[model samples]
Target chain A: MVTTVNLTALRRDIASLSERNALEAQAPRSAFGFGDRSIDKVLGKGLQRGALHEVFAAQMHDAGAATGFVIALALRSSSDQSPIVWLEEDFAAQEHGFPYAPGLNHLGLDPQRLVIVRCSSPQDVLKAASDSLGIRGTGAVIIAPWSNPKCLDLTATRKLLLTAQQTGVPAFLLRLGAIPIDNSAVTRWMIRSNASRSSGANAPGHPVFDATLIRNRQGMTGHWILQWESDNHVFRQIEPVSGAVVSTPAHRPPQTRKSATG
Target chain B: MRLTALDERAAKAGLFKTMALTDARAQFENLDIAFASPRKDAALLEKLADWCDRYTPLVALDGADGLMLDITGCVHLFGDEHQLRRDIHQRLSQHGVVVRSAITGNAAAAHAFARHSAGDVIEDSALTQKLRRLRLVSLEIEDVHLAGLKRAGLRTIGDVEVLPRAALAARFGAGLVERLDALFGYAHHPISPRCVVPACMVERRMAEPLIVMDSVERVLHALGDELFRQLQQRVEGAREVEASFFRVDGEVRRIGIQAGRPLTDTKTLFRLLKERLSTLAEPLDAGYGFDIIRLAAVRAERTQTIQKSLDSTVQETEEIGGLIDRLSIRLGTGRVLRPHPVDTHIPERAVSLEPAVHTAANPPVEWAPVQHPGEPPERPVRLFQPPEQIETTAGIPDGAPAQFVWRRVRHTIVLAEGPERIAPEWWREHAGALTRDYYRLEDNRGHRFWVFREGLYERGQTTPRWYLHGLFA
Candidate 1:
């Protein structure tokens, strides 16, 4: 049966409908690789866009792994039309001589499309992140130094999520060290070095390492290992480690507690 | 010959509102004033205009309801500026017009006086006295903010003048008192004129007013031609041109045009101006006919004095630039852009976008390491801002992906190559210190992908999660 709606009533209904439609709009989500395919599959088509994806180090010294993971993801995910915005917190580019430049280029990202904004203070980084969300055609924005607890406050996280949803751009946060695992993020996991292999008759043979996927948002965690080819600038996965190494100290760390799920 | 005796009864009766209100209207009334109420407008304005003409010839419209005059050098023409001002005011009063005239050392002071305090004429010697007598508010001072002064019993400018400025600043805001001092001329008060005064301007006063649009257009074209001739004689080319039409009904119509390359061609100038005018919603109307039409060269740029070359090739480049300029004006400035290279290792950071004309052709940055598309990169077609975390249970940790689920779908890894193991840039001090375990895993469905874990092996560590960074497809 056709319902006869009044003009004013219909207008009010339309207004509410639009409001509701906006409120109920599906939040944008994205998926980026850790340069690992098995892990990407379980991540629900990668990372969620228009949301904050966080990575924490096992310890402060292991920060290189997280950074490497982020740079690879940023380069791999970015398209020719849309670029990445890397937000730095008190990071001196000249002093480090563009640490991620070579890796990012090797990963097939155009260096010019990447706009790096150096922020001395957390306030600046947060403000810049919010502003970047409004820029059209920006694929993703990476906010590093996710360590400051204040950086990921509820207000900022919600804003980041809303911005990503609104614009369909992804945002990533890299913290200094492992934070208290909470369900603020859509997924969680831990990474560790693969068992080192004895190779090369020389001093420094090809570096062979393995990684463990300790957590997942929607699937079971497992272990993957590969060797880095310095000459080709690529990684080639090797055979699975023998059963002895599965529980050995090389791949598994001692008694790490699982992250609390939401 | 006749003796007059003062009689109290014959003297003017006590002032009444009706009797005190002058029937004579002002020359220029404020915008807020009533437009119609049995008041004479034209005759009163004519008398004022005549009186103002005696002061300067460059008088023009001011605000929505005001008049501005350029008294440069001409002030000396009328018996020392003071006498000239007094005579002008006396003439205005004789015509039953109330006027306020100010004769200052400069045009700004004169204008400020005419607008703010239109009373008695101020002489240079008694300028301070007149300024002191004027209310502080007249100098744009906030009255409610005089609390500190009230406590100190400082009532007037004269009172404040006696106290040390340093002491006064301590008691009150320094900026506030400094402004007051500047206004009073204790310090220099440099004034910037509202509009840039044209160095060379030409006006054509018609013998008879014109009402037809064709006639106005003819005058404009003629004026443009004449200005171009003058420019040619002086070896100058205008970058911007403005044509102004002043109507008898006080309506002004202005048409402005800009040139890509400075030129003084009347045909091109008219074409541009006509095109601009066509876009106007309201056409230029000479309500009561126009009395004057002026064509001015607002800005100019130098041109080479090269001999006229028969080279058609030379003209083409200039023509193209002109075309781009016109097209840009019609469309928008940022419609066309050029890509320039920047120094960065990240692929996306390689190029910057800028306006084609403004950008330098040379790349701004240089990088040694560059990867070509020919090289197989494990780069995903779509990359996430941050890698997504995933759960996995598969083969040994030291090998290719055995099996995993992404986006709620499970995939058994068949062919996978990675553990690229990109380390964190330690110097950046990123918040999420991650040790990523990156891998390129292919599912049984023939689709390959990249994924990584955010952080390295450790328990009780908060940061780091497994994330699917990007897709190969």
Candidate 2:
């Protein structure tokens, strides 16, 4: 006799199976960000430890801001004493500039725990990433290849992902000025220079960024206005429309608007 | 081509340097020949000099092919000067490296005798007799001067010794007399050693050469233990430790470790050394094998703690220090850096980077933690290395911008505060230097920025410009 399968029940069954699988593999193979529920929820319980994550910028100018965001993530992952190895391709380092330790330390990521390695090419970057992934006591391994390196493809990223999984180390891949490349990254973030909103008016206030969750393996993609709270080392989501809206040509004066004048 | 060099076999067959290659070939029809590489020979000599460190720590490369060993107080360690020379000769010969070694009270005398009277040991009292027996070539003077002397009936040093010092000085200039004085130990002649002299050193010379990392590690552990014992007896600690591995192939590999604090612990030293070796960019090549390993405490300091200072925070601090040391070693000395804020108003000159391991913010000048009670942070968490130029328009001539465009994104100012004037220090003012009016601005959105307007309207011809100096995060 032929029987009709219940698809919804089958979906439920698979979901439960995955939940049990997570529990089985729950031997300290988990990472959570900043202990903030809002970020943890967005990141699907802290970025899935022992996995590769991608942080990219929409344009070349946003590389600095993207770097800052990535650094924040690394700082969140690493303890004060544990070191974070930042591997940058030679070209990327040239374009984006070297990491300024004093500024970074001011931003609350312990400069003492950050190790910057300049690799000649993307292949060298991947090689260093793979080697650093197995280091047991480090906080995190971060790599940013040249804008679009020839060898920074899905195959290489997949290999890095597997290594991260095996060693229970978190690796962040920064794609400077490049759009998302199809890979096995658990999450992809696109950060740009968003006008920072602050609570106070006169003195400089907290830094704010409009971060878009471009890719999410386990959940839906979303956008948020997040402010990095340096003191607390946590991120707060600011209501987007409430802050200063990025002015378009429509917001400009009549004399200054070229299109309108023309 | 001329025969610039000849081996022992060719020398025995009556061939000498400066002889025509064609004549040498004609004399011995089937003679084996090869090209000469002076660079390679010099490299081999340096390696040999490094190997001689096994005899004494003060071994220096002498000229092109000789090594000067200051075995002054070290001779007794190897029984005596004659025994040390014999040991060096036998060991070098076994390695197929023909060597001539001599020991004497003076450096130049030892160098001269090593070649002319190979394997000779001349006591301080017997120096005169030895100088008399040695040929004029032993002085290592110029060939032109030596030929002049030879033509003048001075075939041996004895003939030159009998002559007045003024005569030799007049004949070959003052250099000849000065060299003779140096050779006879009448003047100072100190050989500059290839490596830095250590403060206190302990060495282990293995009976059998070791080629594996395990043996090297074991040797390092034993040396560390012994060093710590000696340091403890003196109530001192090592700040800098250098390990010299004399490979049997004549190469010397040096590894140095600097601790954040004074250290005399063997285990910690060994652990740090192991980490360093494993992470070395150039792997230690124990080609052939390493027969001698020397550990030197190049810098030492009195231990702060007589006994272990038991404190929870102190332990934590030490652990942090250890981590920094390891990371610096693995990465590089300058890779791991900490920022110490300078008391400056200029945004760019406000901080300096220092090696984190040694200059970390120890309690004294800690940058007052970023957030202050009710006051907004005067400084931004992240400052642009070079303040980025911003397009801004203001209601007042020298006031905060009412609207600013950054990276092609415009933000209308909702609230503004500042015009806090920070004039350039007269002593530090440059051509572009001008009085800056800094403003803290809040856009229609809650976003805040630390922007500045430089040069007042009448003060400079160009309109006051705006800059986004730092991000207030």
Candidate 3:
């Protein structure tokens, strides 16, 4: 109360901090990309490497779509020497078919490079995922749970994120037919199958996905229609179609509400 | 009641072996003695033999009360023959056991000399002279033979030695001659060790029982150094090493470490063993602490001499193999794995995770060839075992489904292809088994599904149940 305070200087400090934050968010810290504008453009930066991403589907039939979405992301960052390891936490193999090497080979992905770890419970799967992702050169580790397990709490999610970030390896949590609550993942995606476009009377077109960003740290929640190119191992943008929208309290873009008062 | 044996203190108080326990008590009025059980004595002898194994692996039971140690080539390890004998005597004395030890070249001479005269290493040339002066009891011959020698006025080994060999044999039997030959270092005397003798072995005897892990580790390190030295001499390395810890309370715990390749360096050997010890599910139990620890190379192989250079590719492979070996020790051998391929159409049976060490030695695996070299895939990337049963409705009886309800979700198929028929192998499949008709169905939501119709609808069958087997990219 006794000293004169510069309100203009204080305002300048707040503006400069926000500017630095916006610039810092531009580099994804070594994350790999999905090669799709709908995701990359909204993120402002690329997909973050050495971070955790959570993905879940709404129904059992959509479980396959959820898994494919994660596999595409994992394979994008993996190589023949250091491939992705998938930890099957529950009996998801019975629910959504095991990974077939022949089908994978046909898609130009080497199944031999993939290592599958079958664990008994969700806790064991998370433990295995944490251990595997902690390996320095291991590209990515995937945890696929058959259902929404009550055992996956916030602390467990944070542990996975810490290990992945410490070792500089990405970790993907694939939830089958289960909506996940909030945790430490830098990004959370709810992926579901979108109706495919037909090229001819009998020929099927490219695989398409209705991907919704549920949680984003660097950007805002958005929805996009993405198509998978099997030959190129990339995802292409598709024109937004009707009825691809999922509603749940209409997540407001958090950054848009900021009033600069400039 | 009768006493079978007496200790020195009781004997000093006018007690003796085979005397009536009541009579001995009556004589001293306070003779502290108990009925000697033979079983307890045998157990003690067995433990003593196991304890003596730390000296040389060549320890065997001489009789009810004696242990024979073949100290040949092992004497230098404890400084010299006399020093080893002194050390053994001192250790036993400290254990409250009255012990007499003789370090000799021959087992029989050592056995005979340990009881009479001075328990010392007699020169090889003076062995016969030393035997001549010993009493007949020293020869370790049967009691009947000793009795016969006494009756024949040959009360000592010299008396029997002077007699003609054939005459001596004719009188006391050939057993006397074999005993003389063994005692005089003229015949072979082999000892059957209680434990298997490894290719190379090193051991450490603790003066004080080691109850802590650090002490065990220290002993293991010391023993591993000696073993590593021996392995170096043969220009070979140990492929599998076994470490045995003998507890003071008579329990033996063994830990074994297996390497992906032959390992000789002491640092690597000790490091691997330490990792294995720490990772054991049931940790090493040292009840009452261990008195002796032994390190032995159970198996060995010729180590390939690599031309050491900055060639990192070869080094990387070796480093990875080492990492796998370390991990297998902790996570179990089955947990650490490498993908191996099989030449089969059944997907589950086509690929499996094998122990990483097995694949580490073999050449890189080649995945199955693609059907259409470079085309966008029409099949799903992931396939599951026991294809999941899905409720799908088809237009024609044998045709693919235009719409299907799976997991409570109905999808209308917009485009579909494939009727790739896969019949179960005739020899492997039973008669009435269905030949599968697989179809790639693309629902309106671009959800690609691999649905297979089992058996033909015309073959006296109900509605052919469709199973969803895979999901393509």
Q: Which candidate number would show the highest TM-score if scored against the true structure?
A: 2
Residue-level lDDT of model 3, residues B1-473, one tens digit each, is 78887787887877777788778777888666665688999988988887777677787888899898777777777897778878888877877889877767788888888877668878788887878989998877789988888887777788888878898788778988988888887899798777666788887778899998887787788888889889888988887889988887655677888877778788877768878887788988888899888889988777677877875556645655565566566556675565667766544566776776456556658787666553446567677677878888788777889788877788777678878888776776678777888888877555788888888878877878888888865
Off by over 4 Å in 3: A1-28, A145-151, A197-205, A240-262, B1-202, B221-242, B257-281, B294-327, B373-379, B403-412, B427-434, B457-465
Tell how far residue B346 is off in model 1, in angstroms: 5.7
- Clash pairs, candidate 2, are A196-B447, A196-B448, A197-B446, A197-B447, A198-B446, A198-B447, A205-B472, A207-B473, A243-B445, A244-B445
lDDT tens string, model 2, B197-269? Answer: 7777888888899999888888988998899888888878887899999887667898999876667798878
Per-residue error (Å), model 2, residue B320: 1.1
- CAPRI tier for the interface of model 2: incorrect
- Give each model a TM-score: 0.38, 0.68, 0.65
Query: Which tens-of-lDDT digit does each residue in A96-155 have in candidate 1?
Result: 123344444544455554555555566666766766665545667777644554655766
Interface RMSD of each: 13.6, 5.9, 5.5
Candidate 1 lDDT, B75-151, residue by residue in tens:
66666767777766675566565566666644444545676776545566787666665543444445655665656
Query: Quality of candidate 1's docking, in CAPRI categories?
Result: incorrect
- Model 2: residues >4 Å from true position, as ranges? A1-206, A209-262, B26-31, B143-153, B166-171, B208-216, B245-253, B280-290, B306-311, B341-352, B357-473
lDDT (tens digit, per residue) of candidate 3 on A63-158: 667777787778776654565677785477666776665666665667655656666677767766776776665657888866767778888888
Which candidate, 1 or 2, has the higher DockQ?
2
lDDT-best of 1 and 2: 2
